[model samples]
Target: MAFVGREQELAELAEALQRAAEGEMGRVVLAGSAGIGISSLLDELESRLADVPGIIVARGHATEPRSALPYAVLAEALGDALASLTDEPFKAVVGSAAHDLAALLPAISPRLDALGIGREAPALEAAEQIGSRVAESLRGTLE
Candidate 1:
């Protein structure tokens, strides 16, 4: 189906992106009842942002055989983009919690290793437990 009018939605997203670029933080959730072409809208928005600088677009899609958690769908979608997230100028942005992140995302282990970090990265209390340190690590990386 052809991508039709959603100029207002697109503009809102664009404005949000601009605000983020100017160092304003915000969370975006595009949602509605099923079969409302959310995927196409996201694709279009992503395409529009393809050339925008200081922007890192990570997409999360919800599809069949979904998870029980309400946010799991989007989380699952964004999870796949984790590698890309870590691959960005991570070393440059990450701060004191480098080892914590190394534990969280092993893909970054080698980079951390080269920097002489995480040789003895602290062990998480549990794999399922994500402490505030890791969250701050990510905020720093994304900022």
Candidate 2:
């Protein structure tokens, strides 16, 4: 079901997408608390874009609590990028990022290891530093 109050927002998103299709770069930032429909809006936008030609969508979600794990979100977003790699050099660079992250956060490391990243050196940092770096990494990955 659609949120009854967000008709204008959806229309504006559609307009921005139309402009982007014509070679314009448009960005939207929705700032609000959880359950305020930001994710839903983003989901709607992505769903609308799915049928458009030449469109690629990469999404990352990092909550404050889960954001402490280094590169937790980047690794998720990069999975598709990593999968698209057939070349050795690009694969090495991106693969190393994935591997290093897995080793850094023990909770996530085993899961990533299951995905084939193995034997990586730990990314040593304090808890606060890890959180800060993870947020930074997420922002960088989005760009």
Q: Which candidate tops TM-score?
A: 1
TM-scores for all predictions: 0.64, 0.44
lDDT of each: 0.63, 0.56
Give the Cα error of residue 79 in candidate 2, in Å: 5.0
What's each prediction's clash count? Answer: 0, 0
Q: Sum up the clashes in candidate 1.
A: 0
lDDT of 2 by residue, 1-143 (tens): 55567789889877866786787665554566778887887787777777776554545566665745545555555555444434453335435455344444345454455556555544756767655654554344333
TM-score, model 2 to reference: 0.44
User: Which residues of candidate 2, in runs, are more than 4 Å off?
Assistant: 65-143
Q: What's the residue-level lDDT of 2 in candidate 1?
A: 62
lDDT of prediction 2 = 0.56
RMSD of 2: 6.5
